[model samples]
Target: MAIFTENIGKVSVGKAVTWDRDAALLYALSIGAGRPDATEGIDYTTESSFGIQQKVFPTFAVVLGGSGGSMDHLGDFKLHQILHGGQSLVLHCELPPQGSVTPRSYMSAVYDQGKNAIIELTTELADPEGQLVATSVTSMVIRGETGYGPRPERAGSWAEPGSEPDAVIEQATSVDQALLYRLNGDRNPLHSDPVMASKAGFPRPVLHGLCTYGMAALALVRNSTLLAERGLGSINARFAAPVFPGQVLETRIWNTAAGALFQVLADGKIVLDRGVATAAAAVAQDAAELQDAAAN
Candidate 1:
């Protein structure tokens, strides 16, 4: 199948979507936040004042991508073959405990690799008063689903580190990470039912896509030196394999001028690769403004 050149510049902006406390809480739970032994504190899972102020789990931004858009319309490709390659989010400010938000999203770029395709999409979330809340970018890699034809002008592949990664972080998924994540409203039984999962070619229930997403986020937060210095501005990655619960994920980090390159590996195999996270420059600007205010 060939891509629709006419849809190259396609864009879609959606109405403001209000998120209540329930929604926020539910999203947190979806990423295994409430689990008894998860690294995140138990306050997030309980009803308390401190829980209300807890940082929103970063992976919750995935829900914001859906308003109205057809993947088929954008590319002459099979939706079934489309896999979420990677995702990244930057929080402009602390999200309010509860509030409404409007999200604007669009396809920023598409690269054809002859045998595969890379699609990049961006989404912006704003509050009712028109303040920007968060910005997210997602990259999808369609394997064996690329459009047939001549190759475009060549651009070099992003550089990967030649030396051993500077750091490695590992985490194991709970047996119920998928079941727990489904409470957030994604009812895909592939993560819940053993029979369904087997039918889908898994020996057991699989983890939720967002759970894998959260694991990736944890990798970024725990291992990146740049994020600690300036905060995460964005992340881009490609998902390469399905992760079953109870698998130990080892995330490796590589430093670069443009961003930090990372990968998520399971069972000694690379499951999520070509991962990148960029830090926010505005954090320094905001700090400077605060310093000036304090001096005044």
Candidate 2:
């Protein structure tokens, strides 16, 4: 295995990436928006007062400064065997309708867990003007790839659900989700061309994992009834299963003192298991004070 300790600092992966209207449209389509049968019925492409504006999906930050060949460099790691363990994003500002963005990525930390290795990466995106647009932190748990030496300490997992969720929100994907998402400049082919997918060991074209992540975010924003209350502060989730296009995703949420717990289920199976989001405490505090004043 490669020791990335020396690489755990500021690293530039790519130059300025142009963000345009087409990119925004594709991202919206990837997440099941703008479909003929969409439940939300929001036209993201058109200038509308409702629905998300022509903005890049928050989760796009993960791919921004990605090193094209990290897996190849890591010895003994079967790239196919590795999975995206979790994703989280913090938006510093609303994505502009169109602009150029430069991202700086770096290895934030590495945790050796005896049986597994947990790698953390962070990327910061800035507009041409040097204004911060967004920041993302991703954690990848390399299962069964550990024991190079003594283990390191890491944060504990989120508290497991002690009871059933309080509410469940369901959203179905359009059959063209993968195809549309690819237009967002991903061009991975794994999500579109069937031949490519088969080569990757998938039965058929699978939706971009990030597409599902965006859908889960939409579910959380809608279900928590906090879209207008709390600006999206943070979203963290694990991809439990591959969701093909045209599958219905059911997101279950539980309100907590810290934030909200969530899970995305498809066809009665948990696809995004063990998800959690932390909202800005400032909003929650303000809401509480309003409630107290009303009670008085």
Candidate 3:
């Protein structure tokens, strides 16, 4: 069956979600934080470290506030035919080590792209008190779903900065990176099963796009003291290609007046592009504040 465009604007019921210190720490390590050198990012990795207080990475909100939109309503389609096209996230405040929130997802839009259809979902997560914690917008491309109309065009383009990047941080994904990242809630076999990957036209299982996204976010925080102190107000990126596990990911960042423009490259090929990281208000410069985001 084809994507049900009629499902657009559908709203999902609120679903409660919670996470604790262990979940946060696991997310950090899955993205290769504090690896090889345990001392580098003790704040995110070790909860009971002498005097350091563990803090959650701002990107952790993505896992918590996933598109609660139900795919079953979108009509029948094979999972392997879908691709993670893009993602955008906005955080309202610093995530505590442990917290609970109810998330509701909306089927916002469905666009025809000639041979494929793009389905966008928007999710809002709020605390028990009804204060918004995070908002996430995710887009998925369904392959071979054709004949709706011409593709819609985004307004702007991502131009490579003329000057050199302000910062470049490289992180290596282990051979088991996908295996570990799957534990974070995404269990799509495309990242685990070779047979399923073949059905998706991949030589082998590829890394989760969101995993690479989270890695890029953490890299930015570790490379910039300003970002670490201020925290990230928002992050947006478009997936340009698939990144296989065991490959090295290099995040190139150009600091902008608004925040920063970034891209993630693997083996010299840009895998994530049109990236933007919005910096939150700067907090007081203190030891405690520094430790809170030491390894974001």
Quick one: best lDDT, which candidate?
Answer: 3
Candidate 2: where are CA atoms >4 Å away? 35-45, 48-57, 60-63, 66-78, 141-144, 148-157, 280-296
RMSD of each: 5.6, 6.1, 6.6
List of clashing residue pairs for candidate 3: none
State TM-scores per candidate.
Answer: 0.76, 0.79, 0.86
The lDDT per prediction is 0.67, 0.68, 0.83
Tens digits of per-residue lDDT for model 3, 60-155: 889985668458887688876887899988787788899999988887778787679888888888999988888898988889887667645652
lDDT tens readout by residue for model 2, 75-188: 455665566766777666566656777877777766665577766677788888887777787767777776445534534236798998877887888888777777665678
What is the lDDT for 111 in model 2?
Answer: 69
How good is model 3 by TM-score? 0.86
CA displacement after TM-score superposition, residue 185 of candidate 3 (Å): 1.3
Report the number of backbone clashes for model 1. 6
Where model 3 places Cα greater than 4 Å from the true spot, the runs are: 75-78, 146-159, 282-296
Best by TM-score: 3
| Candidate that beats the other on lDDT, 1 or 2, i.e. the better one | 2
